[model samples]
Target: MKKLLITGLLALCLLTQNLLSQTAWAEDANDSVPLKTVTLSEWEAVLKSHQGEIVVVDFWATWCISCLERFPHMVTMSERYQSKKVRFISMLLEDPEEPEAIALAHQFLNKQFLNKQLKGKNGLAFDHYSMNENLMKSFEVLDLLGIPAVFIYNKGQLTHRLTGDNPNKQFTDKDIEEAILALLKSS
Candidate 1:
């Protein structure tokens, strides 16, 4: 009986050690996946890097009612077409150089956000390089630029550019869905 009890305790100790070692190994592996604020270079790299994938880059702000309103369509499109190499990235252009826009974004998200539903809990990725003039040029937003600018890049080439509040000033859920599908089809 004494020998049996000792064997059981030994087995339990070994099992516990094995479980902890597996968890530690998994954590170490997962630590390499970078989730930091992506720079414009990094965003561009991701956009231009994909070989056969369609990347939908949305230039939007938290303050833009038109931008926020189209988010449900964005999320829906993301989920609906996630399996077909469709990458949706919504980036915020919050510049220290443009304090007024940032302040307006803050007020819009805070003071009048329907108790913070539209702003999202964590908010958009604001550190992208498009905030820089050079990066903006790289994005090809020089002469004809507009808020909530959606660029559909297929196979690293600019395919479709949808500008303004749905371009025709008639933003609808169907338009977003169709745009996303059009981009995905090209890939």
Candidate 2:
């Protein structure tokens, strides 16, 4: 009985060690993912750089209930439509003055990537931004008056904007997919 108990404990130790190793590796991978910080001028430059491509920008905030609800769907859409012509960017509408908000946004992104919710060939290619009021105004997201807004730009021109009247309304992956398909078909 003593020998059997020892063997079982040894097995458990090995299993625990393996689990720790796996968890460490996942954390390391997530740590390596770069989340960029861009000012309004930098953001405009990025937009200009991708002039010929279809850009989908999601305007969100960590505290926004509607944004949180729609984030998973946006992740899935980014993964599903990974393409050279189509690019996905997430603009976190957090005040740049608040460091806590930026840190929270990074944490949320890390979790999303670690869980494979944001997986694709272009998943890591997704650019993240913490936009100030100026940036928000430049993108016209402030006028929309809500989080979880999505805008599609074709060849540097604003093509479509999806903003909901009610914050409780959740936008589905299919809704974004349909918009992307229509845009692609047009070009």
Candidate 3:
């Protein structure tokens, strides 16, 4: 009986340590790097890094026209509310190794996106960040429905999503601002 209790105690201690270590490991992996969100790889830790804060994640593609149109507002909001509780991230949905496509991506981002919010991975890690077409579809973020297809995550739950490229039709920065404020207050 004495030996059993000792063994159980040791097991419990080990379990607790393991849980703690797992939590720390996750955290370190997420906050390992920081910058304006741009690439899919950058978003690998996004959901993790933005814990306790509001995260608006935009899954876009260079070929996406709607994404281009709405890119400016996203970048502006990211910079404007940067000091606040919200963090905005942009991830490309296309493959990076395709030199021609990537070049086009860069040009589109520079000219149309205006390089505002966050561009990540520097090159491409679309698959690494699980932003592939299938993955996006799994997350319900796929389909050529729109650009700047933004999802607002509050406390880890998707609170709102805007799935369109037409700025004239989708939510504006003002709308985003209001949503973030309200969500943060309620949370």
The candidate maximizing lDDT is 2
Cα-based lDDT at residue 103, candidate 2: 83
What lDDT score is found at residue 105 in candidate 2? 81
lDDT, candidate 2, 41-154, per-residue tens? 777887998898889999888888878787767777777777545788888887777879878887787777665634433445466777655545644634666767888899
Residue 111 error for model 2, in Å? 0.5
Please tell me which model should have the higher TM-score, number 1 or number 3.
3
Candidate 3: pairs in clash = 37-118, 37-119, 38-119, 38-120, 39-120, 66-165, 67-147, 67-148, 75-117
Q: What is the TM-score of each candidate against the true structure?
A: 0.53, 0.71, 0.54
**Which one wins by lDDT: 1 or 2?**
2
List candidate 2 segments past 4 Å from native. 1-32, 115-123, 132-142, 165-172
The most accurate candidate by TM-score is 2
The sequence of per-residue lDDT tens digits that candidate 3 reaches over residues 84-175 is: 75766666666534556655554555553333233344422111132433434534433445455677888777787766456577676677
Ten-residue stretch with the least lDDT total in model 3: 123-132
- What C-alpha lDDT does candidate 2 achieve relative to the native structure? 0.75
Displacement of the residue 160 alpha carbon in candidate 2, Å: 0.4
Alpha carbon lDDT of residue 114, candidate 2? Answer: 68
Q: Model 1, range 1-187, lDDT digits (tens) per residue? A: 9999999999999999999999997865443222223565676666666646676766767656788777556655665665665766665665546767755554443333233222332332211223444435534643335566677667778776677634357445566668767765544
Runs of candidate 3 with Cα error greater than 4 angstroms are 1-45, 95-97, 107-144, 165-170
Clashing pairs in 2: none
Candidate 3 is scored at a TM of 0.54
